[model samples]
Target: MDKLLITRGVQRSPFWKFILWILPWAMLLAWGLYGAYLCLAEGLNQTNMDNRFAFGLWIYLDLTVIAFGAGAFFTGFLLYILKRHELKSVINSAVVLGLICYSGAIVVLMVDVGQPLRAWFTFWHPNVHSMLTEVTFCLTLYLTVLILEYAPIVMKNRQIRKVPSYLVFEFNLHKLMVVFAGVGAFLSFFHQGSLGGLYGVLRGRPFAFREDLGIWPSTFFLFVLSAMAAGPSFVLLTTWLVEKLSKKRLVKRETMSYLGKLSGVMLIIYILFKSVDTLIWINSTSPSSGFPAFEYYDRAAFGTWVLFAEVVLFGLLPALVLLRKKLRERMVWLIPSAVFVLAGVALNRFVLTIQTLALPTLVFDEFLSYMPSWQEVATFSMVIAYGVLLYSLSFRYLHLFPQERELTQPY
Candidate 1:
């Protein structure tokens, strides 16, 4: 009975052991739900967010996961659209991770809005003029695409597939996957850019504002590039971690190398544009707006060194390492480099959201400082717990690793 649900030929932890491990994640999710309840029941006042800081940790986490979740569409683009058959082994895992990340972020957004029920207003009433309005539409639709992509994987379970109807459904879904992938990639590109555009179009806040290129800002293209760069590295790291956890080789090393190279190429392109954008903004945009580029650092926390670390330590370092065949091929080098890449993208989101709000627009208005209320921390932790639970369960029961059976069975 215990083994019935586990995929045939794949070994997993004892059922009770799995249950014990899941307990912690479940508890955390419950705690987070309570925090979300407080936010909804009491108000957004429950969070550290204020008029100046309209966004908080939840928005930051949303950006982080959404950026990382770019893995799903990008991988599908490589495998199905580009016909990179070598990626087949890792694409399922990418979809599962993407499903978790996208779904969890959507859930957080629901809670962050303070009235989960009113979320439909974006779709119903429709604010065609607002970037966030566009973002909401794209995210909601793309999330549906992710669900469609994920359904066939879930329906592949031993017991679920026993149903002839489910078997037929999943089979047909797989056939139409490329169409879905194309649509997903299309939606993802626009939404990811729009999310960045949300901040860039903030002409009222010079720190956050950017000069628009036609309709979109430089930040628009920068976001799309950065997301593509981070997505592949995240997929590589997740696949590697799954390998360590399962004690099995789930993907060919060449797949990892290929992903590293892909990521490296994208990162170099992103960093170059990012450098040019920063120079243009500091030289022209900031001064024209009467906010000197250097004046941003009047608040000690947003020091000059942050720009260097974001660009050089995290951005430049990872791109250089991943681009090198000799270095990225080694696990030791690949792991840290991938980690730095993730950190770099995450820091980019943080500065874009938090630092912009923290800076004082008026000389008399003090630079605002915020520490997240416990409710905010718990709410964010909830998403992390949800992701862990979903991924662990999917890995345990689904044939997410196509190479699992061959690798686990003796040659």
Candidate 2:
């Protein structure tokens, strides 16, 4: 029964093995759901987050996953809008990844908002001037665009394609893909920037604040560029992991190399701007906000070394590694570099979210160190389990990797 449902041209692990693997993940999902129920029933006191940290693990994870998910819209823009034919190989996988990232974020956000039922309030009673209002609008619209984009891919599954309507619907969807891709890219651009601006607008927290680049803060563009940099690298990393786990090649070396090159170039651009932005904040923005920037760093927690680690160790190193032909072509080297690129982005999100909140705003206030409760960790683990479960099922039943057939000729 399971074999019949699997994609026709590809081989999969035995049914029992697949079942065994998902059991733990299913348990994790249950745990996460229980944790969410607690948060909703017992209220915000269940978590460690207080007035100081209104946004906790849920928000941090949301920011990180969505940023990493940029590969979807960016890849779509390349394949459909910019006319980059090489990205066709990974477009399906990229879309699925984006769907997972965006949907999971929405779920976790429901927990973060305190009253899950009130989520509709953002839409019904809109605040036009708030940065969060802008984020809500773009995020919802872009997520819809992603669903429209990936729906046809699900219809492409062998069992689903048996229906004539599914086939015809999928075909028609392909024609308007350019429109969907354009909308998704435009929406993604604004929300990605607004997320950064969410903190930038916080004048009280000079550590998180940035100078306005015209109307938007410098952090706005930085967020967009950083997301684009991580997007392709995350795709490369996931493809590599799938190949390793399934023991079958899925994409060509040249295709992976192209992604690596693009990722590297974008990282370089982000780093250049980020470095300059950091210098400017240290020199001008912090001072203009009526604070001595170096005074914020007069403690052990957020030292000057943190900035160097963010820029040099993770940023410049991976950029160079991905750009080097000899380095990127080697699986041993390229895989770790891709991991570093993703880690760097994760670190950046952590700094912006946690560290920014941890710092004190007043002269007499003490710096803070946040530790998530068991509930928080469990909920976050649920996000990872959700990704594993969905990706497992999708890869088993659907044709996520279009080149899987050609690449695994021996299978």
Candidate 3:
């Protein structure tokens, strides 16, 4: 059965080894499901979130994963629209990662909403004024586009491709992929911006509030830039990890270097914009709102160092490393640079979601702190287990890396 499903000419681990490898992740997924059930069945009370900290660990996870998932649309945009042929090597893997990240985020969101049954109310009773409404619509549409993009990959599986009708479907789907890529990019741009806009519009939380740039806030564009920068790095990191785990040269060194360079360039642009935004917020935005920017950092657990880490240690440092031909060419420096890029993005999201909520808004109010309950931690853990399991299955069955055979086999 395994042999029938596996792609021909590619060697996979023995069935027993595969099962052993997946066993722990499967158990973790089960535990996570149980935790999710507790959240949905009992109430959001099962988690540590409250009125002050309504958006907690779950929201942070959603933002981080969505940013990491940006690789799918950005890579597609490069390959199909700009005609960067080098990106074609990793495009399929990007699509799968996008699907997993997005679909998982949506699942976590449903549980977080605390009323899964009433989730349709957002679409049914629309709120044109809300950034969240825009996010909801774009996220759904983008997920659909990702599914369509991923379909061709699934249909290419060994036994699946053997069917005449499936082959025809895959062929037709390939032709329309560029269109989907365009739509996916459009949707991703808006939703990614809207997520940031959601926080930026918070007048009550002066720490998060940013001045409007035309109609949208500064964070809107900032989020889009940061996600674009982090996306390629995430893809590069995952590809390297897969290569190491499989002990196969899945893609050429040139492809990896290209990805690193792209990420580095975008990171530099993002850092520039972010630095400008920070200066503006500190000098003008926060001051105008009657809140000193330094005060926000003066609180417990969050300090000026967090900002420095996000901008300099993680942002500028990694961007420099990735941009350097000598550094990015070496695996030792390249992998850590990618990791730092991701960490910077995660820290940005953490500051937005956690630190924003922790700081007091009113003069009378003191600083507040909140932590995730076991249920929240488990539910989030579920997403990681799900991604690993799904990727493992896809790699075992599908031709995820197009260059694998050519790179490994004799000429």
Candidate 4:
């Protein structure tokens, strides 16, 4: 069968190496599936999560992926709404990554819920005031937008294009893509913000709670800005990884540089707001609630270092590095800076999810910690494996790099 995602003039490794490339991830996938089986067979008893730690590693991974995946919707908005034609080169890969992240998160969420059988109750019961509900509605709807975004790419396959109906449908979808992109951006903005709202509204946890602006907390806007800041960084990192693994230039240096600039600017802005938010929390919110700022940082594992890393090293440092014209243009500096930018977002999610739970709230409560059981780690590994396999398949089949066919031509 003809491949759908291989680049032009690029020859893949031998069948043996191909098998080797997949073997480890495949094993991880199997382990995750086995864990899922146990979870379904035995229930949440297989994991370490308790009533206090109701949202654990699984939720952390889900929200983090969704936040990073914001590149798809944001990039689409730039390309379709703002008419940023230069972004077209990387848009296809962004869409692919978004589809994988969103779908993978939804899958993990299904397993994470206490009553997996009653998962639909979230929608059916409809807790209108709950932040979780808003997350559910937007996530589900935006996932549809991602699917629509990915459809044309799938249809563009050499073999798939041979089907006339598919070709026609693809063309129609392409024409209407602006509308889909608009809907996706709207949904992404809400869901990404709501993920922050998830922690913000937890008034029971002084560490996570925040003062509201109207109905939503300051973290709500901070999350939206943070996700936007990190989204392009993730896309840049993913593309760089793809280029390294494929041993080909998948996108122009200028395009990567532009994305770096965008991410850097947003990161700087986000850091400023985050700093203000932290000061306000420490001075007003925490004090009013009868908790000192140091009280939350009292945990041995989650100390002041987390804050430093998230704010200074991973946050402001990367922003400074990326914003520089000299550094953004150099591949050596560019790749590592992109990595740092991505790390900052991951750290942000970690502080919000794990740190919030790790901090003792009630006077009788003690600092808590959690390590995912083998079952939990396995389930998480499934997502990584799935992403690798999907990206491999897409790279093997789709024209992800527009310059490929032009760069490698037959005489």
Candidate maximizing TM-score = 3
* C-alpha lDDT values of all predictions: 0.90, 0.90, 0.94, 0.87
Cα TM-score per model: 0.98, 0.98, 0.99, 0.96
User: Which residue runs does candidate 2 get wrong by more than 4 Å?
Assistant: none
For model 4, what is the alpha-carbon lDDT of residue 386? 89
Q: Write the per-residue lDDT of candidate 2 for residues 236-355, one digit (tens) a residue.
A: 999989999999999999889889988999999999999999899989999988888787767797787777788998899999998998888888878888888888888889889988
lDDT of 3 by residue, 189-213 (tens): 9999999999999998898999899
Top candidate on lDDT is 3
Candidate 3 residues lying further than 4 Å off, grouped into runs, are: none
- Candidate 1, residues 62-91, lDDT tens digits: the string is 999999999999999989999999889888
**TM-score, model 3 to reference:** 0.99
lDDT of model 1 at residue 125? 90
By lDDT, the better pick of 1 and 3 is 3
TM-score quality measure for candidate 2:
0.98
**Model 1 lDDT, full chain set:** 0.90
A best-first ranking of the candidates according to their lDDT comes to: 3, 1, 2, 4
Misplaced by over 4 Å in model 1 are none
What's the ranking of the predictions by TM-score, best on top?
Answer: 3, 1, 2, 4
How far in Å is the alpha carbon of 164 misplaced in model 4?
Answer: 0.9
